[model samples]
Target: MKIKSVNLETVCGITSKMPENDKLEVAFAGRSNVGKSTLINGLMNRKSLARTSSQPGKTQTVNFYNINDLLYFVDLPGYGYAKVSQQTVEKWGKMINRYLDGSKVLRLIFLLVDIRHKPNQNDLQMYEWCTHYGFNPIIIATKADKIKRSQKAKQIKQIKETLQVVEGTPVIPYSSMTKEGREEIWEYIDMVYEG
Candidate 1:
């Protein structure tokens, strides 16, 4: 899908209400420091529109980016930051739940994880939560270039086994720096919108 126009249409904080959107919505979920913003920036073909930061837990709101006036790329707040307090984390969790339970236009979720390591407890919980809410999330393993060529398969296998993902879920190895796997992700989005 060619992005002709991009607009940051909506931003929902922890206490704010999610907008009642009519277009198809796809969300990106992952832990802090997982390159969620970087992936979004790469996907949108823009630099820093999603606000990549040097610090973890930078994104604290549900940001909705209107794409070509057809779909919304919903950037959910990143979770699992150790330096953050438990109460703040819980609030973010509630914000995510509110979005999942209330978004009528939500069609898919792209769950991002670091490709160099195993899935953590928060990652597992997030995966289960997405499935429980009827979304078979597409796993996007970020930082693919950080690992060696031979290690990729083993790391991917570890992620799958650790998460216990559902059968046939796509686990895409993505590199924001190299823009690898970006086309496949866009193709999947096109498929969802076309069908």
Candidate 2:
């Protein structure tokens, strides 16, 4: 995954049509405030291109980043924000589902969870929904830098148990600030496409 070029090539709103892309697609799915934009920026080796925000629910649309013209990094709308209205949340859910159902080039989905706490109900539901859509989402535990080194194993175990992920599924702990676990993620991505 040598990122020779990266471009924010597509932005799909609630009613916008998903591009009929010809490259492999990988999606990132997670709750709002999960540091998704930061992770994406790190992966692209660029700062603030994905638009990190102080407010939750800031990314209200699906963003597609063309990566090296070989793959598409799909940033799905963040879910499970408390301040959003029920109607708006429902629409976001539908929009995500629609993209998952419609994309023909989609190869994998990475579901991010905050590492400081056990998986919540929304996280569980999202995990289940990803499975229901025929995806074995690779879980990325975000905010790894916020926790103590001694707590890392325990928290990762708790997250896996709470999500009830199948045996052998990946659960990676990632830190945007330290850029830890970035190479492991890139290796996994490259393997999935190259192998």
Candidate 3:
């Protein structure tokens, strides 16, 4: 999974249609401020290709990043932002649902959660939605560098329990700053692609 080239191929807004991509698609879903953009940038090995911002809920569209022209890293809009209006949130939700229902190449979803906190209601809902769509999402515990190494296992356990993930499901603790767990993630992606 060595990334030789990365392109922001498509940006699907609330009223826009998703591209009928010919390549495999893996999506990233999580709550606002959960470091979705950071993780995407880290995974892509780029600084600002995914557009990280100081404000939460800045990602308002489904960004399709073409990875080495082989697969797509689908960046779904972050959910559960309080500052956003209810209508806007609903629109975002509908847009995500449309993609989930409409995408034919979507293979896996990497659900992100903050390592420093328990999975919230929104997080649980997102996990449920992924499962409901018949996708067994791989949990990525972001901000792992913010916690102590000793606390990593405990936090991962908490996330699994809170999300009620199926047994043996991987909950990887990842750090965008240190790039911890990046290789594991790419390995899993390769496994998914191969399997």
Candidate 4:
């Protein structure tokens, strides 16, 4: 899973706008400001390949990044941003749902969450949606570097319990700052590609 070339293919506001390529797609889905873009940039070993913004709700579209022309890393719009209007939220919902449902090349989804807090209602709902729609979601607890080593296990446990993730699905602790869990994440992605 060595990434040789990473290119931004398109920024899709709706499913119809998604790239028509048939390459395997692994999407990153999570709430706003959960460090989705940061994770992607870290995973690719590119500092600014995916834009990182201090402000939440900056990613309002499905951003497609082509990796070595072998796979597509889809950055989905973050949900549950308070500043966004209801109409905009609904539009986003439809766009995400359509992309998830219609994409045949979608291999797996990385559901990112902030490691510091409890899983909120939106997080629970998104997890449920992934399960309901038959997408294999690997729960990623991002920003792991913010927490102490002693608290890591407890935080992971709380996230598992709160999210009610079952035995098969994994909840991996990850950090963009330290590149922690980066290899493991890629291993999982590799497995998905193999499958």
The most accurate candidate by lDDT is 1
Candidate 2 local lDDT, 49-144, one digit each (tens): 887757778567999999998899999888788888988888888898898888898888899999998888888988888888888899999999
Whole-model Cα lDDT per candidate? 0.91, 0.88, 0.89, 0.85
Candidate with the greatest TM-score versus the true structure? 1
**Which structure is stronger by TM-score: 1 or 2?**
1
Candidate 2's C-alpha runs over 4 A off are none
2 or 4: which has the higher TM-score? 2
Q: State the lDDT of candidate 3 residue by residue for 9-51, as single tens digits.
A: 9998888989999999999999888898889988888888887
Runs off by more than 4 Å, candidate 1: none
**lDDT-sorted candidate list, best first:** 1, 3, 2, 4
What is the RMSD of candidate 3? 1.2
Runs in model 3 deviating more than 4 A are: none
Local accuracy of candidate 4 as per-residue lDDT tens digits, 21-115: 68898999999889988899988889888877666774578889998888889998888888978887788778887788778888889999999
Model 2 lDDT on a 0 to 1 scale: 0.88
Q: Write the per-residue lDDT of candidate 1 for residues 126-170, one digit (tens) a residue.
A: 999899899999999999989998998899899999999998888
